[model samples]
Target: MAKKVWVERNKDGSWDAFGDDGAHIKFGHGQGLFDPGDLMKLALAGCAALSSQVAVESTLGEGKGATISVDGTYDDELKGFASFKEQIELDASSAGLHNEDVEKFKERVQKHIERSCMVMHTYEHATPVSEEITVKQ
Candidate 1:
């Protein structure tokens, strides 16, 4: 299935993005709003956490969760993010994962995210974007 989303500028000059599920996010150049770069980082972190959820829960117990953070520096010259770093903090001791087991679990989680996280995959491999312009007379 194809999903469609759009961003519209409000009369107050702020922008709101709408998704197919009726969720809206306030975005613009101001406080309490997310810019495009901020949304990108959020998406990356969310994707990583979701894609690795199965592996994490299976080994770390169902209730155990993790914190995933993504950071990147915006480059004015390039007008885009230079690079992104993703960090995941997980406590394995609760699940009794020792040195070897912990190492294996780390590998498993990495594999799961790398294999299934579409956002990370897009970052790794460049996806082409094309734009079409329309003029109202």
Candidate 2:
């Protein structure tokens, strides 16, 4: 099944993105609205959290959560992101993982995220995007 997503301009001169699943997010220029670049960063972070969930919970016990933070540098001349960094924070001490166990757990989660995060994979592989515009009379 194919999911549909679209952006529509608002009466107030802002824009919003909507998904066929009823997801909505405010975009474009405005306070409290996420620009496209912001969304891209968020997507990477969100993907990391999800892809690493199993490894984290398996090591830290169920219901234990992790925070994934993403930062990137944009290259104005290249019109693209120059670099990206992601940090995953979890309380291994609270989970009783010490010494080698903590190190192994971190490695496992990192490997899992690197392999399974589609968003990150796409970004790393430089997926191409094509635009199609429709005009109505």
**Which candidate gets the maximum lDDT versus the true structure?**
1
lDDT of 2 at 103: 83
The per-model lDDT (C-alpha) reads: 0.89, 0.88
lDDT (10s digit) by residue, model 2, range 1-137 = 87899989999888988999999888887798887888889999999999999998888889877887888999999898988888889887677666888789889999989899999988888677899989999
Query: Which model scores highest in TM-score?
Result: 2
Q: What lDDT does candidate 1 reach at residue 120?
A: 88
Candidate 1 Cα deviation (angstroms), residue 60: 1.9
TM-score of each: 0.89, 0.92
TM-score of candidate 1 on Cα atoms, chains taken together: 0.89
In candidate 2, how many Å is residue 110 off?
0.7
Clashing pairs in 1: none
What's model 1's overall lDDT? 0.89
Summarize candidate 1's per-residue lDDT along 1-137 as a digit string, tens digits: 76689999999888989989898889987888888888899999999999999999999889776799889988999889989999998878768767899889999999999999999889888789999999999
